[model samples]
Target: MRLSLISSIRRPGFRVRPLLGFWHRWFGLFAALWLALMAITGSAVVYYEELGSWLNPDLRQVEVINPALPPETWLGAAKAEYP
Candidate 1:
């Protein structure tokens, strides 16, 4: 039975050939549209940080910081900032 099914698919002028072609074209068309949307969404996510800074100018400002602070002092500053 399986051999007959396989032979039917490979046979010339069989109904299965056109059915397979129709499915292939349908899937390819939908896949292309899905791929395009994914590509655009991926690009937006990849530049999310830059886009966020561009949209919110306040986040783009820089401040000078003292990097020489000790670990304990940094921990205290972090606690104060969060608390």
Candidate 2:
């Protein structure tokens, strides 16, 4: 089957409506500002996790104990609950 691009083909004599032209221009400004805000916020959100880790030292802090918990302790607890 052959697909037609009839609607995409521009008709030679174009009629421009005055009110529509005004509306387009009016909405165009708002659309541009909205897109700009989206771009800025999107970039900020992308780096937000990395920035948070860098900014908050408490979140990055790790408690160092002399010895780590033995695997037997976790295995015994798991067996007690699951078995």
Candidate 3:
């Protein structure tokens, strides 16, 4: 009776064409979301160093030249320390 009709619709090997379209649509939607996420994160990584320096400028500062011992004195220290 009515059960036979419902069984035929739900039978094995029955092709539901609309579900195929829905599957493809959802796949495309998720792919686009993944792509957008990658693009945003990629941009953030590319600018990470600049962003860090800007946020903490004190850590990126260069001081004026300071007086130092002569090269001979540095070489003597190096010889004593390394050799």
Give one digit per residue, the lDDT tens place, for model 3 in 17-66.
Answer: 97899999999999999999999999989999999998999989888798
Q: Residue 39, candidate 2: how far off, in angstroms?
A: 0.8
Compared with the true structure, model 1 gives a TM-score of: 0.52
For each candidate, the alpha-carbon lDDT, in order, equals 0.90, 0.85, 0.92
Ordered by TM-score, highest first, the candidates read: 3, 1, 2
- Give per-model CA RMSD: 9.1, 10.7, 6.3
Q: Write the per-residue lDDT of candidate 1 for residues 1-83, one digit (tens) a residue.
A: 99999887775766777789999999999999999999999999999998998899887897769557788998999999999
What TM-score would every model get versus the actual structure?
0.52, 0.50, 0.53
On lDDT, the candidate that comes out on top is 3
TM-score comparison, 2 vs 3, better candidate: 3
lDDT of 2: 0.85
- Residue pairs that clash (backbone atoms under 3 angstroms), model 3: none
Worst 10 residues of 1 by lDDT: 8-17
Error of 2 at 17 (Å): 2.9
lDDT of 2 by residue, 17-49 (tens): 866998999999999999999999999899998
